[model samples]
Target: MWDDVFPIDQVQEIRTKTTVYLGAGAIKKIYDIAKDLKEKGVDNVLVVTGRSSYKKTGAWDHVEKALKEQGMGYAVYDKVTPNPTADSVDEATKMGKDLGANAVIAIGGGSPIDAAKSVAILLEYKDKTARDLYELSFVPQRAVPLVAINLTHGTGTEVDRFAVVSIPEKEYKPAIAYDCIYPMYSIDDPELMTGLSLDQTKYVSIDALNHVIEACTTKTANPFSILLAKETVRLIAKYLPKAVENPQDLRARYFLLYASMIAGVSFDNGLLHFTHALEHPLSAIKPELAHGLGLAMIVPAVVEAIYPASKDILDEVLEPITKGAEGAEEVAKTLEKWIFSVGVTSKLEDEGFKGEDIPKLVKLVRETPSLDGLVSLAPVEGTDEVIKKIYQRSLKPIA
Candidate 1:
């Protein structure tokens, strides 16, 4: 087993660029937030979001009303897809530039908010392409100020500078991590999540759960991350089932949203391992598959594969996740069972991937230059062949 390979000589500190406001109707704080930005000379703003849901959920109306009341000029870029692409970021940047947007406000889930982050940065880099952003060839000194009013409890994109942007043509999705892309602030109102379907709540909650599990299990796990991960795991294990069973449970939704932010901070600091690396290619190839479901499908397989190396840490975290389950294998089984109970049961085969797709996914993992950093963080050796075998294991039904 590889010992924790991170720099132990350097002390790890917890920090965040985004300040969070949380409550039942916390989204209403956007009105004052917009006014403050306007006072600070952010006159024209870009509102990045998805279609129909924002309107259907009344979030867009709320934001529109705020902008109108504040007399702030705003343009809406609402074409953000589930797995947002570099092309979409470029298009949104073009719109923000055309509208002379000096600030960005994002509503909806991770995709739109993440797109907003890239768009804000790209607005300043008129000469650079989204491809340059994805390739890390250029780093903007700053992004236009961003404010996120989260509509989903998942992604936690509102609180972090990282954005997962897809190069769909190449069948790759890599995170765009830069210092300046963090939001100026975030408003996480559990009320917004009330309209979510049970499936939506379950899948997104699972994504947050994975963030905690991945961060706690990574080589960089420290005092801060360990605390956050344990608390996040316990909260999700207790509240996610309740949220999934009763989508209108305000208590459940609130805690799940809290856990999402906690897990986001944990992973943002500790970084993730093979779970994200393995899950990325699946979604990149099948854009229709929900990101959380893709993570759900392969998480147990990767955990089981890495058990030999991660057992001690897995044992420590297993009780919080399993309540009483012990040992690495039992923890994995319990995790998978909990995932099944929560309603995500799709396998790679069920998602339309065949035996041939395994090699394709393996190749994508092997070829993704940026993935090497994340791949190297896995507790177990993640050789191309080992990654290929994990993908093979995922071909069977998860249940």
Candidate 2:
């Protein structure tokens, strides 16, 4: 079955700066990774994670056991919330500093891993604050070593060099990409993902879908990004529903996890544009909103707007979901129907956003740091008016 989508002959190791340990029981490598880190003078480490998933996913047991066996001191900062904020990053940084941590171990999905990346930066640059990082006030040159034990099949933070954090007071949810933040060692173990809820399974896969959609259509897109983007879409279209139906399906989880990893690498090489640029503000304002849900709400409108400029590439990359749908409007509608079929039926309005919020959302997008950079990569110009129209179209259910 896997050969039909991603051929066996094409399977090859991805050589990146980060060393990835994949497959079932990959978490066991943590013991050796921990020993190696300790040899490099990493006497103490900061463990960043959300409150419950660390133990629920059965990652904490392996991570904790590894640290103990290596005699490595570690501290846990488990208060990372969804849509992690600068405040949380600041708090975690303080904990890492106080613990004299020389390394960071991120043990959750994107939220904790991203937060850990920020914390790692702050730990290295002791004088810099989370505000400085998110605001782009400082260009980070280096960070302490990071080990990511990814428990979710989405975000791909374990392998990517991007970190997003919200500064709610400024209503900014900006992303930072730096070579310094890529995890030195990462684990993608599908066995740790069986505990994900149905909503998590659906939402994370949607996030991967959005990643490739924007990556392939962006101005910097190359043949490499297009190749991975199509495969990412195919894997998600085939496996997401299976994982959603039976959360314990390891095969589905494995493929979905693989889809997300490549999606991360795709965007890392090709970058992203409108959908991610616009969705950050929505989650920034409503901190409770899931990032994937916000992307799902905004992506159809983005596809409709950008399809004219990137018709050929968009049509090819989105083939799995578009299913022969031609033209911009029809392709957008087909994509919307696929999102709905995956149980993400809510519109922006249902998620407590209204048409009146468009101006604020647009303002946040324009004023937020790093966002305009993302918008500029859009195939079509993402003007203020264009941005507003996308938000307006997403306010209600698809007609």
Candidate 3:
């Protein structure tokens, strides 16, 4: 929502002042990239990452020793978490400032990279109130150079000028949008995710599928995003299960990562609709329900609700997803099959959500702005009556 451009050039300015840092299987590319920065007379370096990032990956020691051999000093900051809250970002920023880190090199999934961007923003504007930070009332004039070495590839928060900071304290526990495009560069290597267990790989890929599907079906659906969502769905359908079945499959990993990245880009352009809007509330109200699983639980219900709105688009949308199943009911059946195939059953009840909560959940869905997009796009207007009906519909067994 913020119209601010990311200060990547300014980030480059910082790197020009310090030595470059690199690691996280990105050593080969970072070898070239860091060498390029070093040749430019940059002299200080720092590696931002997690513990297993250094301990298990061997990339850390490799880069550290390489930098040391070249007479460069580097330190690693490797404590961060998933869905990084603003407080965590503040902590990381404080640590970076304490280190006098000239420039930062980060390698990990969206979590660390998103955290790195926040760290840069918070470090530059540490004096601003949290509300101002969210408002972007004060622009960041200076920033630590950040290059993310991407390990897992969902949420191209890598290239986008946006970050989602969870505000667990808010009544709805909404995510604060911090539009700081801080990752100056991104290294997306599928090999890094090759070690992911099938379950891990499948879950993230399904998350991407949720992104694509919701964005595709959103009220703000545009020509370009439609293609992006469809292509991403195609790729994930064909490749996610493959990657999950054989984690070492490089091509499958690449395809799935590419799907997630494109989905990220699409969502960046136009936001996701009902499912995400509803999911965030569920997450705020219930920490036990992971966002991804929350999405899995709701997608089918969204499909059924939005089904009449644009059956043609939904059919086309669901075609590859359904593998060309004929008829609307069959398409729905095919979609349900694939949802379970990827292991997303709408079993929120098993997750401990109760029948009593359905009405409250419907209330939550009815007022949400994200669902506004579904209002026009779906054939029938997304009414509170319909929302309640869908909630009632979802309580039924998936089979």
Candidate 4:
């Protein structure tokens, strides 16, 4: 039945590697997980996080309290930054290895979880640095177990096998995917996300939305992936605004987190396209600019450029994004309006993406491994000319 709609190679392989505990108070389940890990003879754990967001929200305290109660030894590696560097992964992996960690507890958003995933593989590699891992010169013998406690609603790193790491000196951000990097379990505790600033909420919400949007239109999208994508788009369309307007609304926060996870699962089977491919260099070069903003600036132009070739799914997505809007042009405009309504201004120039930077940005995207293949998965060819045009369009606000 599945193969009927999707070709054999394009068929999605479904697997539920992570046991997810979700909802308002789900963070408390960490205690139960710690107890189980202890019972299973897992001793040392590495608590990976970024600068003080977990500490600010007291989520780290909850994780620590649970580990302490279970008498589990652990180490902290919290130096991860947004668009986390490969060097940081190597540094954290060393700490985890030195602590003899049997497992990693990834707390916070995508950066930390992504770092944890890289660290998991690197901890087992023993002799290789993150540079070697990024270069694909070494594969891990085994991944250290991971428990993902998600504090934000983006990236879906908790449920996916992908990790995107940056090399700052070379101005490159490359993604890595290996099956073993999938977390053993995950927690989507909305309570942990209530502390997110309005911009953080808005940015990651759009990030998740892009995850579904891009995957849904990718060449590999299957029936199941599109179903998940449609629902994810609808949920984000309805809930993101409410969550952003009122951060204290746990219901909105919970559903948005749900959307993020579903999109993660959807895209795990169906890959992404030029939206992510284009956004990579933006964030890689300007690490301070949130990734979702880059997507917002670039997606309208990308959608318009690809619409002629991608119309089947692109037209089908209109009802979800715009309530039965007709035509790809209308969908792109509606998407642009919706993005603007979210308080995300869509000008790459505003983010310091200049004409001079275009060449280097395109160079970085080409230099990044596997991205060209992913970009080629788009209906439109992501040739140097096309990518340059997309970046040039992004410099102005998407109309």
Candidate 5:
């Protein structure tokens, strides 16, 4: 099926700065990666990850063996939470500095990788805080080398230059994109992703879906972005159900991982708009909210609002899910049904939000530092009213 849709011979690596090794046994290359970094004067390394995924996914066993075999010195900061905060980055940065670490190895998914990117910068800046990076107080020009052992199939952080960190006290979740934050080396092994729960698989795939949707629709979108976006959607549509049914399906996991990597690159080049711009505030306000779930809750309404403007392109990009559905309302309804079929049944109200929360969400979208920039990328004007309506439409499940 993959060959029929996108021939394997044609699926060459889309060149970027990151050196990526992706496949069934890609994690084994970590040993050589560690050796290479050591030769480059990286002595002590800061290993950043979530509390349990590193061990749970069994990625740590391999990583530990590689680092130890290479005689690499390392320290671990495993407290990176979902919707990772700047404080966590600061704490990890302090750990790295104290260890005199010269490189960062990020394990697990987006949160850890995103947090690690900031830690990589802070380690080099020495005097800078995660706050300075997240708040845009400084435009970072360099970072200590980063290596990502990606354990999930979403966020595309391994291949992209973007990192999102939250400042919870200020209710801000802003993303930063710098050429330096791109991982010098990345490993995406489908074998490691089999441990992901059904929800994890669904949400992360949905996150990849949202990445391409916004990428192709953004005003700056180009032919490259659209081509990748279309393939991403098709791959997700074909494999997400199989992976959801059997988490250990390596083939399904492999393609979904491929879809996510491309989606990350797509948005990196084309940028994002409404869904991400709005979902960040949702997760920022409620730290418990999963980033992908927040995206699921709002994306249908975002499609409703943006579809009329980018109808022909979106019709092509969303064809796998929408199935020739015509008009904005029908397309949005079809998308909502597809999201529900994936077992994400929660409305905003189900997730502890109400219509009254719409204004607060809108305010965060406008007031959050980097969010307005994303809003500006929307094909349609992202006015306060337009933002409010998307939130309002999300407050209840589509009936």
Candidate 6:
């Protein structure tokens, strides 16, 4: 138990090595870059795009046409899925090897981007097990270059070097990050997301908000991270609702994407907290509840759990979202209200989680590595009571 909150000014030693290509129609940049690659004699491009999105945008066909127009050789790898499993990785890796792809371009949401990154890493270390990659303790000495074309809101998954992978057979879920995982190109195209469902937009948008909140209030507090987190929360609060309410609202959609992009930058350093830690088990246990919704449901309570250490950060996180709530308590209270406003119908009971699973979930929490990283500076004891309290309080309906 920390007697006081952690003081933070600088978050991480951030030196951006990855190049970002941004525009309303960012995918075109891929065509331009591909042409440039050909000029430089780098051509074996593998296009890893979401199966659904590739069909929708005809992006695979578009990329193929673009490459063929330049007499460039490229392969389309369409084996992408949400919440990727090891089997998905194995399949994707085979595609990369068979094509002899020298570079990769992952199009569409976090799923395809993550899958493409995994495939690139796997190609270089064909001998390494999937387990080694997920652990991220070590990586192959060789890795192929990769680029990402991001769609959808939140997730900032395009910019980060981490990927959340699932093990359905063993019921394990781990977030893997490595220097090798960073995209050589992170291309943000706002128009590409105008087709997203309201639910998809809402969930992803909220996930970005949670990143800022957790990053700001966690045991690790950095001044730069806090400022970025605060600005991210303010913009998301201002724009997400409008974006969800009207997909055609181009300005709203643009700002939401912009905010998520900046939040992704903060995520590159500030890291996530217990809301993410506890959420992994829940998502692994029940795929129906996306990790984002899990964060929304648990975050109110997670907010309370960290209340002792950083009520001030919590208050600041909540203030803009709440529109001038009295103070930390009210701001925190407003967060609960804001969570509901965003359409998160989070009820563990509704999800069919039995009381027996509580202890099991608690065990997952206690054993989870580096969750202590979130509470590291706070001096937490890392016990069942702490997790149990969060679970119980999170289940309560917004009052």
Q: What would the TM-score be for candidate 6 when compared with the true structure?
A: 0.89
| Model 4 worst lDDT window (10 residues) | 3-12
Better of 1 and 6 by lDDT: 1
Evaluate model 4: give its lDDT.
Answer: 0.83
lDDT of each: 0.81, 0.90, 0.61, 0.83, 0.91, 0.71
Q: Which stretches of candidate 1 lie over 4 Å from their true place?
A: 1-15, 323-327
Ranking by lDDT: 5, 2, 4, 1, 6, 3
Between candidates 4 and 5, the lDDT winner: 5
lDDT per residue for candidate 4 within 1-399, as digits (tens), equals 331232212212234667777766777778888998898888999999998998987788889999999898999998999888988998998898889998899998999999898888877878888888776677665788899989899788888888888888877788887889888889887778888999899889899888877888888888877888887887788788898789987778877888898889888988899999989989888899888888888888787778788777766654656656556567677788888888887588888778999998888788887677778888777899999988887788655
lDDT for 338 in candidate 4 is 85
Candidate 3 structure quality by residue, lDDT tens digits, 29-80: 5655666556655455556566575445545555665566556556666776
The sequence of per-residue lDDT tens digits that candidate 1 reaches over residues 157-262 is 7777688889988998887778898999788888788898877898888898888778877788777777888888777878888887788888788888888988
Candidate 3 local accuracy as lDDT?
Answer: 0.61
Q: How many steric clashes between backbone atoms does each model show?
A: 0, 0, 7, 0, 0, 1
- How well does each candidate superpose onto the true structure, as a TM-score? 0.93, 0.97, 0.78, 0.93, 0.97, 0.89
Candidate 6 lDDT tens digits, 207-235: 88888877776556588668888888887
- Candidate 2 TM-score over all chains jointly: 0.97
Task: Give RMSD to native, each candidate.
Answer: 6.5, 2.1, 7.5, 5.8, 2.0, 6.5
Candidate 3, residue 306: Cα displacement in angstroms equals: 2.2
lDDT of 2 at 157: 82
Count of backbone collisions in candidate 6 = 1
